[model samples]
Each structure stands twice: as C-alpha cells, then as structure tokens.
Target chain A: MKVVALAGGVGGAKMADGLARVLPAEDLTIIVNTGDDFNHFGLRICPDLDTVCYTLAGLANSLTGWGRSEETWNALDSIRRLGGPDWFQLGDKDLGTHLERTRRLSQGEPLSKIVRDFSHSWGIAPLVLPMSDQPVETWVETQEMGWLPFQEYFVAQQCQPRVKKFAFKGVEQSLPAPGVLDALEQADCLVICPSNPWVSIAPILNVPGIKESCEGICVRVAVSPIVGGKAIKGPAAKMYEELGIAPSVLAVAESYRGLIDGLVIDAVDNSCRDELEAMGIHVLVTKTVMQDYIDRMNLAKETLEFCQKLMLYKGRQ
Target chain B: MKVVALAGGVGGAKMADGLARVLPAEDLTIIVNTGDDFNHFGLRICPDLDTVCYTLAGLANSLTGWGRSEETWNALDSIRRLGGPDWFQLGDKDLGTHLERTRRLSQGEPLSKIVRDFSHSWGIAPLVLPMSDQPVETWVETQEMGWLPFQEYFVAQQCQPRVKKFAFKGVEQSLPAPGVLDALEQADCLVICPSNPWVSIAPILNVPGIKESCEGICVRVAVSPIVGGKAIKGPAAKMYEELGIAPSVLAVAESYRGLIDGLVIDAVDNSCRDELEAMGIHVLVTKTVMQDYIDRMNLAKETLEFCQKLMLYKGRQ
Candidate 1:
C-alpha cells in the first residue's frame, strides 16, 4: 500500500525508518516537521528533517538516535574554544547538511529542494520531504520564560521551563511542500508517527492544506508517542502533565480525536483499548517501544496491518 | 622602543611572529591587512588577520605558514562531501575563528574589537589589529577574468590569471582602525614586514590617514619581499613581473621610494645597495629568507637595527 508518514525528530524518525523498511522506496513518502528549524552560528539547521533523512539513510547514530554515526566533534570543540554557542552540538558530518543547506538557501533555493538534493546525495531511496518550503518556527510559551524558540527551550535550556503552549509562527501562511498534498491524495494510509503531538505533528498539520489532505485518505492511524504515562523520548509527557492533562494513550488518541480512525498503543496501555473503542476509534495494542531494529520493524508491520483493518472496517460501514 | 609592524598573510605573519618573539607585548603592535578578507559560506574570514593572530598565538602550522598546527580537515571534508565550496579549505579549528567572528560581526561588533577579543582569548600577548574596522576587499583585475576577489584569485584560481591591477574597494572611505593612528603617532619606528607590497602593505597604506601617519614617523623601514629577482613566498614576484617591473630588490625599493627612509634587502642583492643609496634611501643587506624560527628572529633584529641607523643618519643630517 502507498504510505505517507508524518514525522518529527528522533521518535518520529525511528517510526519513519520502520515504515521505510516495510514499504517500497517509491511507495513511502515521509513528511518531516521543519518547525524545529533555526539559524545557529549563521547556518540554517533543520533538526527533524536531518533526523529523518539520517535515519532513512542508515547514517544515524544508533545509540543517540540523532546525529551521524561515527560523527566527529572537531568543529563543535573549536567553536566552543572560540566561545561560540556550545549548547547545540553540531557534529562535523552533520554540519555539512547545515552548511550546504544554508548556502543553497541564501542562493534562493527552497528548503524542500535542498533536502531532496541531500537525500539523493546520501543514497536515500525513500522520499523525505520537509513539511513546508517556507519557514514555520515553533515557539514555546513557558512559565519562567515568556516565549522561547523551540530549540532554546528544548536544547539550550534542556526543557527545564514548565510548558504552557506552542505557537507555530508562519504556519498560517505556509503551504504544504510540493509533493505533500499529492502523497496524501494517493496514499492508502496516512500514519502519524510516534512524535510529540504539540510541537512536531501539530506544526505539520497546522500547515494550510496538510490536515485536510490527510483527512481525505481512506485510513488514518496514529502511533502513540506516550506509553505507560511517559514519552518514549523527549518532553512530550512532561509537556502534557504541565498543560494539566494526564499523559496516557487515551490522551494521545484524544489529541488526534476526529482526524484519526485507528490508534496504535503499547501493550502496557492495553486497558485503554476498550475505552478508545467505545469512543468510536479502533485501537491496536502492541509493543510500541522500539528498543532495536527488529522492534522498529515489528511495530511498523503491526501499524500497517492495523491500517488495512481500518480500511476494511470503513468498507463494511 | 615602541614598534608597529604592518603585515599581511604568511610571510608578513612570519615577520610579525619574529618581532613578537623579540619585543615585549606592550612594546609591539602588529597591524594586519584586511584587504584579503572575504565572506565565504556566510562566515567572515580574515585571512591575514587570522594568520598574524595564529602565528603570535603559536597555533600556526609552521610548515604551511598558515592555519592551525595539527588541524583536522573534518569540516572541509564534510563540506566537500555535500558539494559545498571546498576550494577554500576551512579546517575544523580554523572554522571556530570564522564562526565566532561572523557571529560577533552580525551582532554589530566592530572587526577590530573582535580581533582584539580573539587575540586575548588565544593568549596572544602582542596586540594584533586589522588595518581597518571597515571592510576593504582587494579585487584583482586579471587577463583571464576581469575582476576576481582576492581569495578567488589567490586560492581558487591558484594565481594562474596574469595580473593586470588591483583595486582596494572601499579603501577610500575606510579609516585606520582604533589605536592604529595612535600606535603610529607614539611609535619610535614603523617596520613594513616582508609581505606583498601591492596587495598587503598597499591596502594598509591606502587606508585614509595611515600612510600619512607613517610619513610623520621619523624612522620608517621596509623589509624587501623580493630576493634574487623573485618573491620568497606567494605571487608578489609574478605580480611585479606581470606589471612590467623587474621583480628585484631595486624594483621593491622603487615601489616604496618616497614613503620609506630605509630598506632591508637579502645579502644576495647587496649589489644594489649603492643604487638604493643614490635614491636617498638607506639600504641594509642581510639574510631575509626566514626558513625557521631563528631565521625570522635574526631578520627582525636586522630590520630593527637598520631603522636605528636610519634614525642616527637623520640626526647627523
């Protein structure tokens, strides 16, 4: 089946990678969040786009799930010595992406085209598209700091400030990238990968036509980022708690309530399956924690099968 | 005696390093050429200023006469991998200087202050100053290409293009940086380091009020970059030849005829001493080729002694 996966950073990249393993290169199109994109040291840096690209290319550091494997920090070490920003660690190999991307951007090339070119250069077969060609910066409102750029809150401050809300600046003006609408239109399934609902998927969905395009798809399924009341990665669970909501599979399902027809929750949260079913959402309880490559592939396989079941249920109705 | 040495890239940096070794930190100030500075990959790169700073900080690659010692090419290699401009090789450590300098410049900091801060951070004792806080880019008019930026001509084109002339863009409005005029006014002598007269020393002199300040000084001596009808390093000799002037000690002397009171030439060109004297300029014949640290120190000492003799001769006259 033709699959379109919406992804964020590491967690999303992991899920995207899993989907890539099951789907044909031409059949899978992974749309990556670009809300975390920021300019650092005068170079344009796209965290989620790079993560998805690296993971798909099999160049990601397996241990960290971000950055390149066997990456060198010589540039970062030198930057630190010169008293440049050391909070966001830019490895030598990864810096190539930012440097080239920035150069191209300055030369008037769009981010999507640059990402496309980079993916081709890295021998990536599956299509990886940034959510928008235009910038849509994610700004986080925190209790301590009024409004912090997503990276400043996430990376520089280590996500310490209590979460309030997120604003995807420029999202209203941004159109989904060139192939995004077409991918959604042609896809049999639209899978929202296990990424933060607020920062990651929200920014992508908030783009003008992206959500409406996904709504038109036959089967729309979402993999829960939260399992057993905690996020598998990043500050999603903490953000949920701070926002006065209990972090759970039901909360994740509710976050995507009307848009998604099926929800893929972890085995640990199976008790919520019946409750989710009662709310008219199909629930699939499976192992969602991707501890290894096999785990990623298995979760991906189950998610795809669940999408097929959702399609059958829709036909029966 | 308080001394100010005017310098450019590798050769000039060598002379500056020699002066730094012999003169106390408070007694010496090295004013470097900023004409060769350019923006590459969105980073402000000051070739001559960085060379002088690296040499003084003892971080320069002695063999290559530029860049950091034992530097890794990770950044350049990565840039190359991404098909970015790799013609201008930026080592990982060297990129640190460029990145920080660019950041500070973008933040509206003056180039001179940034250089001063970087020098202090590197533990460089002697003051290292760029000729101007304002940019004065050297554009070379060549037979092959009409006008190429200094780095494009020197590094990218490998100086293959026949020299026509050079224009110091913005030199007319550019003022000598802070402390430069004061250093000249209070200086006992001004030593024009053995750097390219046309591209390096000329740019500094071209700065408004700088050449006039040097003219007001009693003792002004220049060490000849040309020896045995050829430049010891770089394209100075070729430039002289291309400009229809014989690349010799006599030609070098004539280039600075009225501006300098004394000239330091290599021992091989001692035959031109009488001719230089006839032009109302004192000539000192010595070993000007600096192959090692001791050679640099000895050349610096001879250049200083030549200035002292010129001072004595002026007193006698």
Candidate 2:
C-alpha cells in the first residue's frame, strides 16, 4: 500500500525507518518537519530532516538517536577552546551535511532539492520531502523566557521553562513542498509518527493543503508519542504538564482529534480504549514502545494492519 | 627594539614564528596578508593569518606547514563523499576557527579584534594582525582563465595556470587594519618574510599608508623567497617567470629596490650579491632555507643583526 508519513526527530525517525523497512521504495514517502530548522555557526541546520535522513540511511548514532555514527567532535572541541558558542553539539561528520546544504541553499537551491540529493548520496530509496521549501521557524512561548526560538528552548535551555504556547512563524504563507500534497493525495494510508504533537507534527499539519490532503486519504492513523503517561523521548510530557494537561494517550488523541480516524496507543494505556471509542475515534492498543529494530518493525506491521482493517470497515460502512 | 614583520603563509609563518621566539611579546607585531581571504562554504577563511597564528602557537601541522597538529579530516572526508567542493582541505579543527571568525565578523567584530582574541586563546605571545579589516580579495588573471579568485587558482587549480596579472579587488578602498601603521611607525626594524612577494607582501604594501609607514622605519629588510632561481614554496617563481622576469636574487632585490635597504638571500643564490650591491642595495647571504626550528631561529637572528648593522651605518651617515 502507498503510505505517507509525517515525522519530527528521533521518535518520528524510528517510526519512519520502520515503515521504510516494511514498505517498498515507491510505497512510502516521509514528509519531515522543517520548523525546527535554524542557523548555527552560520550554517543552515535542519535537525528533524537530518535525523530522518540519517535514520533512513542507517548512519544515525543509535545511542544518541541523532547525529551520525562514529562521529568525531574535534570541530566542536576546537570551537569550545576558541570560546565560541558550544551550546549546539555539531559532530564532525554531521557538519558536512550543514556545510553542503548551506552552500547549496546560498546558491539558490531549494531545501527539498538538497535533501533529495543527500538522500541519493546516502543510498536511500524512499522519497523524503521537507514540509516546505520556505523557512518556518518554530518559536516557543514560555512563562520564564517569554518568546524563544525552538532550538534555544529545546537544546540550549534544555526545556526548563514552562510552556505557554507554540508558534510556527512562517506557516501561514508556506506551501507544501513539491511532492508533499501529491503523496498525501495518492496515499492509501497516512501515518503520523510518534513525535511531539505541539512542535513536530503540528507544524507539518499547519502547512497549507497538507492537513486537507491528509483528510482525503482512505486510512489516517496517529501513533501516540506519549506512552505510559510519559514521552518516549523529548519534552512532550513536560510540555503537556506545563500547558495544564495531564500527559496521556487520550491527550495525544485529543491533540490530533479531527485529523486522524484512528489512534494507536501502547498496551500500557489500554485503560483509555473505552474513553477513546466513546469519543468516536478507533482505538488500537498494541505494543507501541519501539526499543529496538525488531520492535520498530513489529509495531509498524501492526499499525499498517490496523489501517488496513479500518479501510475495510470504512468500505463496508 | 620594536619590530614589525610582514608575512603571507607557510614560509612567512615560519619566519614570524622565529622572530616571535626571539622577541618579547611587547617587542614585535606580525602583519599578515588577508588578500587571499575568501568565503568558502559561506565561512570567512583567512589562510595566511591562520597559518601565522597556528605556527606561533605551536599548533600548526609540521608536515603540511599549515592547519592544526593532529587534525582530523572527518568533515572534509564527509564533504567529499557528498560531492561538495573538496579542493581546499579544511581540517575539523581548522573549521572551528573559520566558523567562529565568521560568526564574530557577521556580528560586527573587526578581523583584527578576532585575530587578537584568537592569538590570546592560542597562547601566542606576540601580536598577529591581518593587513586590513576590510575585504581585500586577491584575484588572479591567468592565461587559461581570464580571472579567478586567489584560492581557486592556488588551491583549486593547483596554480597550474600561467600567471598573467594579480589584482587586489578591494585594496584601493581598504584601510590598513588597526595597529598595522602604528606598529610600522614605532618599529626600529621591519622584516618582510620570505613569502610570495607578488601576492603576499605586495598586498600589504598596497594597503594605504603601510608602505609609507615602513619607509619611515630606521631599518627595512626582505628575505628572498626565490632560491637558486626557484620559489621555496607556492607559485612565486612561476609568477616571476610568467611575468617576463627571471627568478633570481637580483630580481628579488629589484622588486623591492626603493623600499628596502637590505636583502637576505639563500647561500645558493649568493652569486648575485655583487649585482645587488651595484644597485645600491645591501645583501646578506646566509643559509636561509629553514628546514627546522633551529634554521628558522638562525635565519631570524642573522636577518635581525643585518638590520641592526644597516641602522648603525645610517646613524653614522
């Protein structure tokens, strides 16, 4: 089945990798969030896009779930010694991507085109598209810091500030990248990978035409980022708590309420099944914690199977 | 005695390092050529200034005569793998300097200020300064190509193209960086290091007020880069030959005919001493090929003594 996936960073990359392993090259397309993209050391750095690309190519550091494997920090060390900004950890091999991407971008090449070339270089088969070719900076409205760029709030500040709101700065004017809408329009299934709802998938959905196109898909499913009342990674749970919502699978479902037809929750959150069903959302409570490659593949298989079942039941209705 | 040295890259850095070892921090300032500075991968790279600083700080790669010791090439290797411009080798540690310098420059910090800070961070005692804070890009007009940026000719093209002419694009409008003229005006002696005279030392002389300031110094001397009719390193000899001048000590003396009182030539080119003397220029023939630290120090000492003798003779006159 042709599938389109929306992804953020580590958790999203893991799920996308699982999908790529299960589906044929032409059967899967990953639309990555570009809102977290920022310039560091004067080089354009797209955190989520690089994470997704590195995961798909098997070049990602499994330990960190980001950056490249066998990475060297000589550059970062030198920068630190020079008293330059050392807040952002840019690995030596990872810096190669930023240098080339920035070089190409400055020369007027689109972000999508550079990503496409990078995908080809990494021997990736599945098409990976950025959410938009234009810039969409993610800003966080915090109680302590007021308004800060997403990276400063996330990496630099370590997400200490209480979350008040999230803003995708240029989302109002951004169009879906070249192949994004086409993939959504033609897909049999649309999967929102287990990523942060506020900062990750929300930015992708905010891009014009993407959410509407996704709604036209036969089966739209969202895998909950929060499992067992905590986020698998990142500050999703803390953000939820700071925003005055108890972090749970139900909160995840409610966040994507009108966009998804079904919710895939972890077996630990099975108690929410009845509540979710009452709210007119199909519930799939399965083993959703992807700790290893096999776990990822198994969860991906179950999720695709659930989508197929939803498609069959919808056809009967 | 206060001294100011003009330098370019590897050869110049070696002489500057020798002088730094001999003189106290307050006694010497080295003015480095910035004509070859260019934006590569969107980062400002000052080759000569970096070479001089690295050499003096004991961080330079001894084998290559440039870059940092024990440098890692992971970034450049990855860039090559991605089919980006790999002609200029940027060691991971070297990239940190470029990145930080670019960041500070974009933030309105003068190149001189950044170099001063870098020198301090590197534990370099003597002052190191660029020729100008303003952009002074060296462009080479060649037989094969009309005109190419200095790095494109030197690093990318490997300096194979026949040299026709050299142009410092912004030199006419550029001012000497802070402290350059002050250092020259206060100097008891000025030593032009054995760098490419055409592209290296010439760019410094071309900067407004620098040449005049050097002329006011009590003693001024230059070490010949050409030894036995060939440049020690780089395309100096090739440029001289292409420009219709035989590369020799006499040619070197004539090149600095009016500006210098003495010329330091390698022992192999001592045959031209009489000719240089005939032209009213004092000649100091010595073992000027610096193979190691000892050689560099010896040459530096000999050059300084020669300058002192000239100064005493001028005082007598």
Candidate 3:
C-alpha cells in the first residue's frame, strides 16, 4: 500500500525509521516538515531532514538522537573559541550536509531535489519530500528573545524561552512542496508520525492544500506524541500546556479533528479512547512508545493495521 | 624591530611560527595571500591564513604539514559517504574556522576582521592580515579544467593541469586590508617568506598600493622558493616551468625583480647570486631551505640581519 508519513526530527525520525524498515521502500513516502530548516554559519541546515536521513542510513548518533554517529566536535570547539555561534551544535561531519545542501541550493537546485540527492548518497531509497520547497522558518515569539528562530529558541536558548506564540515565516506565499499534496492524494493511508503537532506537523498542515488534501479522501490517522499526559519524546506535552491545551492523547486528537480520521494512543491512554470516539473519532489503543527498533516496527505495523481498518469502515459507510 | 612577512601555507607557516617565536607579537605581522581563498561547501576557506594560525598556535598537523593537530576524520569520512567535495582535505576541527569565517563574511564582516578573530581565538597575538578584504579568486586557465579555481587546480587536479595563464578575479577593485599598510609603513624590515611568487605573493601585490608600500619605505627582502631548479615544497618550480619561465632562483628573482631589494638563496645557488645582483638586485647567499625549527628561525634571523644592513645603507644615503 502507498503510505505517506508526516514527520519532524527525533521522534518523527524514529517512527519513520521503523516504517522504512517495515514497509517496502517504494510504498513509503516520508513528508518531512521544513520549518526547522534554518541557516547556520551561512550553510542551509534542515535539522528534521538530516535526522531522518541519518537515522535511515544508520549513521545517526544513537546517544543524542541527532547528528552523525562517531562525530568529533572540533569544529564546534573552534567556533566557540572564535566567539562565533556555538549554541547550536553542528558536528564537523554533520556540517558537511548543510554545506553541500547550501552549495546545491545556491546553484539553483530546489530544496526537494537537494534532499533527494543527499538521500540517494546516504542509500535512502524511500521518497522523502519536504513539506514546502519555499523558505518557511519556525519562529518562536518568546519573552526573552522576542522572536527567535526555532533552532535558536530550541537548541541555542536550551528551549528556556517562554514562548508567547509560534509563527511560520513565509507560510503565506508558500506552496506545499512538489509531491506533498500528490503524496497525500494518492496514498492508500496517511500516518502522522509521533512528532509534535504544533511545531512539527502544524507546519506541514499549514502548507496550503496539504491539509485540504487530507480532509476528504485519505484515511488520516495521527499517532499521539502525548500518552498519559506526557510526550513520548521532545517537548510536545510541555508545548501543548504552554499553549494552554490539556497535554493528553485526547488533546492530540482534538487538534487534528478536522484533518484526521483516527487517533492511536498508548495502552496507558486506553481510558481516553472513549472520549475520543465520543467526538466521532476512531481511536486505537496500542503500545505507542517505540523503545527499540523492534518496537518501532511493531508500532508502525499496528498503525498501518489501524488505518486499514479505519479505511475499510469508511468504505462500508 | 617591527617586521612584516609575506606567507603562504605549510613552509611559510613554519617560518612564520619560528619568526613569531623569536619576535614579540607586536613586532610581527603576517600578510597572507587570499587568492587561494574560495567558497568550499559554502564555507569561506582561507587555507594560507589557517596554516599560519595552526602553526602559530602549535595546532598544525606535523605529519601532513597542514590542518589541525590530533584531528578526527569522522566528519571527512561521513562527507565522503555523503558525496561531498572530499578532494580538499578539511580536518574536522579545521571546518570550524571555515564555517565561522563564512558565517561572519556573509553577515557583512570583512575578511581582515575574521582573520584577526581567528588569530585571537588561536591565541596568536601577532597581526595576521589577508592580502585584501575583497574576494580575489585565483583562476588557473589550464589544459584539464579550463579556468578552474586555485584549489580546483592544486588540490582536486593535484596540480597536473598544464598552465595556460594565471588570473586573479576581482583584483582591480580590491584594496589591501586595514593594518597591512600600517605594518608595511612602520616595519623596520620585510621578509618575503619562501612562497610561490607567481601564485602566493603576487596576489598581495595585485592589491592596489600594497606593492607600492613594499616598494618605497619597507626594506623588502625575498627568500627564494625555487632551490636550484625545484621548489622545497609545492609545484612552484613545475608551475614556473609550465608557464614558460625557467625554475631557477634567477627566474624567480626576475619575477619579483621590481619588488625585492634583496633575494635570499641557498648555498647551492651561490654562483647564481652574482647574476641575480647583476640584474640590479642585492642577493643573500644562505641556506634558505628550512629543514627544521632551527633552520626556519636562523633564516628568518639572517633575512632580518640583511634588511637591517640595507636600512643602515638607506640612513647613509
């Protein structure tokens, strides 16, 4: 079955990794959020894209869940000594990706094409597309830094900024990246990876017709990042609370109610399934946390099964 | 006495290291060529400036005669696997300098200021100036890659390109960086380090008024890179030969005849010293090839002594 998975970094990459292993390369198309993409040291860096690529290539630093494995940080050290921006840790090897991508981008290659070339280099056979080819940066309007780029807010400021609101710069003029709307349109099932909804998946949804594509035909299911009032990984639950939303699996379902058809939560969040179903949403309770590679595969398999069941029920209607 | 040195990479860096060790930081200023500086993987890489900094900071790789000491290849290896431009040897730690330099330059910081910052970061108290603040790329019109950049010729093609001509792009609009003229005007002597005259030192002269500064007030002396008929390091001799110029010290002196007041040659080229002097150039016949630290310091000292004597003669005049 043709499956389209929406993702960001870290949590999304892990789930994408699981899906890539479980499904045939040709069947899986990963649509990554480009909001985290920013320029550092004059090199274009797509943190989410790189994390997804590295994880798939088995070159990711298992410890950090970001950057390359066996990475040495002499470059960051030198930048720190030079009093340059050392807040964001760009590993020497990891810097190569940004450098090459920036070079290619300067040469007039589109972001999607640049990503395809890098993915091919890393032996990633699955189609990985950015949510938007146009430059769209995630800006966190914070009390401390006023409005800081996502990375500066997240990595540099250690996420300490009291986020007032989030802004997607360039989203107004941005078009859903080539193949994004098509991927959603043609997919037998659409799965949202266990990534942050507001910061990660929101950016993708905001890309004009991308959300519109999922509204009618596709059996869209979101894997809850929040289980038992806590995020599986990252600051999703905290961000939800900061935005004044209840940090729960049901909250995750409520946010995606218009675009999505179903929600999959951890067995620990099985109690919230009734509340979600009461809102006319299909709910599935599974072990949502992917602790290991096998767990990821199992979760992905279960997600696909849930989506297939949801689609079958929709066909009967 | 205040001294200014024209330097390139490796050999020149070694000499600069010795000179910096002997002379107090304030007494020495190194004017490095920027013709070899190019954007690699979108990072502005200044090879000559880096070599000088690494050598001065005692962070130079002893085995390679360049790059950072105790460097890791993880970044390079990953870059290669990612199909990055791996022909140019950029150590993991060394990448930081390029990244920050490019970052600063793109942010509207001048090359001179970036060099000063890098020098300061490495604890190099001596002034290190790029030949010019403007971008001057050395384009080698060659048999292989016609009009390839300097690094493309030297590193990528391994200097195998049959020379047609050397062109420095943007030389006309460029000005010698700040403090460069100050160093030249105030210095007691100037020693042209044993660098390629045509490629390395010529770019500095191409900067408007820089050559004129070296011409009038400074007691300009040159250490010949061409020993007998070959260079101590690099393809200077080969390049000279390919460019239809003889690879002798006399030919080298002839190249810089109008610029130099005196030429320092090896003991083996003592017979040719008279011929060089006959061409209206004062010649110092000494062992100009620096085999070790002692040799580098000794030659620097000898060059200073010759410049001191020339200044005394100037006083008499």
Top candidate on TM-score is: 2
Order of candidate numbers by DockQ, starting with the best: 2, 3, 1
Scored against the native two-chain complex, candidate 2 gets a DockQ of: 0.84
The whole-model lDDT of each prediction reads: 0.91, 0.94, 0.86
| The candidate that achieves the highest lDDT relative to the unseen native structure | 2
Give the per-residue lDDT digits (tens) of candidate 3, residues A1-317. Answer: 88999999988998899899989999999999999988777788899999999998888998888898987788899888889888788887887777678877898889998888888988898899999889998998887779998988888787776777889999989998888887788898888998999899999888888878877556888899998899867778887777788899888988887878898889998888789989888988888887778988999999989988988898899
User: Which pairs clash (backbone N, Cα, C closer than 3 Å) in model 2?
Assistant: none
True contacts kept of each: 0.63, 0.77, 0.86
What TM value does model 3 have? 0.95
lDDT of 3 at B202: 86
Per residue, candidate 2 scores C-alpha lDDT tens digits across B185-277 of: 899999999999999999999998999999999999999999999998999999999999999988888889899999999989878888899
lDDT string, candidate 1, A203-315, tens digits: 99999999999999999999999999999899999999999999998899889989999999999998898899998899998999998889989999999999998888899
How displaced is residue A254 in candidate 3, in Å?
0.8
Rank list by lDDT: 2, 1, 3
Q: Write the per-residue lDDT of candidate 3 for residues B100-127, one digit (tens) a residue.
A: 8887888898999888877777889889
Query: Cα deviation of A21 in candidate 2 (Å)?
Result: 0.3
User: Whole-model lDDT, candidate 1?
Assistant: 0.91
User: Where in model 2 is the C-alpha error above 4 Å?
Assistant: none
Give per-residue CA lDDT, model 1, range B74-170, as digits (tens). 7677678667788997887788788889989999999999988888888999888899999999999999899999999999999999999999999
